[model samples]
Target: MGQAMAGAYLDRGYAVTLWNRTASRADALVAHGAVLAPSAAAALEAGELVVLSLTDYAAVYAVLEPAAGALKGRTIVNLSSDTPEKTRAGAEWFAGHGAVQLTGGVTVSPAGVGQEESVILYSGPRAVFDRHRAALDVLAGVADHRGEDPGLAALLYQINMGIFWTAMLSYWQAIALAEANGLSATDILPFATDTSDSLAGFFTFYAGRIDAGDHTGDVDRLAMGAASVDHVLHTMADAGVDTTLPATVAALFERGMAAGYGADSFSRVMELIRAS
Candidate 1:
């Protein structure tokens, strides 16, 4: 991602300084007129706006802590992944070093960088973001400033990843089941895509009701949902495929039923999740 971001900037005619724990990683960029900084401090001193695409907060500290002396007067755009609390703490750490930290969450992969549809969520002082908005937009077409709180970007990123991984794993489970039934993933592609696409409508329809705490069964009852989930579990079991995913889902619906929400909308399961 760092390489991609730097490449985007270079393509836009911006001078880029490259640095990495492994110096060889910067070779390509260095060949493209980008200066190779000898150390983290040199890199920090090379640019006023320092974009970091590290593994996490710990890696950020590992790289920056020793180079703390050079951080003053720099704006650190941290695109590392970590918990919201850790992100906030990182902002404070940078502030203590006389540097400003702008937290960011890239919603797209390296290949998507610089694409118009690509998004990067940012959170920090709005003034600072505005000051560097153009340069940041070069890395991602949609530089979404989430809020003043430095943690908001990280929080939203984590939420997005949670949903992404869960949905992807569910799709994988379906693929496994299909294969067990002598079907190829290609055969199920259309149906799976349709099911996945339909989730947008479900989310839109349920958002208002969920926010209002209205779990009336007018749309779908927990009892019916539970039965449906059971069928999925049993089907996976009969196919001799892994039932872990469906089993966990069925358990959640069962909990909703046990909580006396059997007559309520299946969306009431949100309550059980929240309580957990």
Candidate 2:
């Protein structure tokens, strides 16, 4: 991702200074007119706007702390992946060194780096964001400032990632179920995609239900839902597949029944889970 970002600036006619833990990866960029830094400190010394694309927030901290003095009066844009707490912590660390800091979550891979479609989030001082907007745009080309929280970008990224992971897991399970019934995944994909889209629409409805604390079941009762869960667990167990997931769901339903919510909604499980 770092190399990709650096390539964007080079293409945009900005002088690029590149460095990495493994110097070999940067060899190609140096050949493309990017200046090679002998050390992390030297990397920041080369530019007023120092950008970091690291493994995580911790890695960013490790690299930047040793170059603290080198960052005096400089602006550091951290595009490393991390939790909101970590992003806030990282920003504070940089601020203590008298350096302006911005933390963001890059939402695209290497191929999207220089494209106008790529999205990068900025969360820090609006003034600092406005100052370096031009340089940042060279990489993302579509960066948005997410207020002064310095953590909203990371928080939003995690929420986005949650949607991805859950959907991916559900899709994999659907694929496995289809294959189990002697149907090819290719044959099921188009309709499965449409089904997933319909199911995803429930998130908004559920969000309203959650906010209103109204998990009343009208059509989808808990015990009625448990019938499907039982079928799933039995089928998975019978097919020698991993039964952990369906088993867990079955357990939740059993708990809900014991709580006398068998006639309530499936989402009522949240009440028990949140109970102290």
Candidate 3:
């Protein structure tokens, strides 16, 4: 990701500096007219806006702790993945060093860096963001400034990632179920894609209902959803396939039903989740 970002900057005619724990890892960028910084401090000192695409907060802290002094009066854009609390703490850490910090979450893979279709979510002091907005746009065409709270970007990232991973898992489960019934994944591909594509409409419908706290059962009842989930579990079980995922879904739906939401919309499960 770092290499991708550096390449993007270089392409934009910016004087890019490269640094990595493994010196050889930066050879390509160095060959591409990016200066190879001798150390983290050298990299920090090389640019006023320091972009960090590290593994996590632990790595961020480990890399910057020794060069804390070099961060004074600089700006740190941390695109590391970690808990919101840790990201927020990192913002504070940079502040303590007299450096401005922006917590960022890139919504695309490294391959998508610098692409006009890609987005990068950011949260920090609005003034700091506005100051470097153009440069950040070099990394991704769409730079979404989420809020003043540094944790907001990370929060949004985690929420989307949670949905992404589980949705993929659900697709895999569907493929497995199809295979158990003598259908190849290729046979189900188009239908699976169509089903996933249809979710956008459901999201639009559910968002308004959820925000209004109106979990009306008129459209889709929790009881109906729970029963459907049970059927899914039974089907998986009867096929001699893994039932763990569907069983878990059924359990959650049952919990909502047991919570007196059987007559409410499936969205009523949020109430159970909140109470838990």
TM-score of each model, paired residue for residue: 0.98, 0.88, 0.96
Task: Please write out the lDDT profile of model 2 over residues 2-76, one tens digit for every residue.
Answer: 999998888888899888999999888899899999999999899889888998977887887787889888898
lDDT of 3: 0.93
Rank list by lDDT? 1, 3, 2
Using lDDT as the measure, name the better of candidate 2 and candidate 3: 3
lDDT of 1: 0.95
Local error of candidate 1 at residue 174 (angstroms): 0.9
The order of the candidates by TM-score, greatest first, is 1, 3, 2
What clash pairs does model 2 have?
none
Error of 3 at 129 (Å): 1.0
lDDT of model 2, residue 186: 100
lDDT (C-alpha) at residue 47 in model 3? 78
RMSD of 3: 1.3
Best by the lDDT measure: 1
**Full-model lDDT for every candidate:** 0.95, 0.85, 0.93
- List model 1 lDDT by residue over 32-111, tens digit each: 87999999999999989999999999999999899999999999999999999999999999999999999999999999
Q: How many clashes in candidate 2?
A: 0
Query: Candidate 2 at residue 150, lDDT?
Result: 90
TM-score of 2: 0.88
Model 2 lDDT on a 0 to 1 scale = 0.85
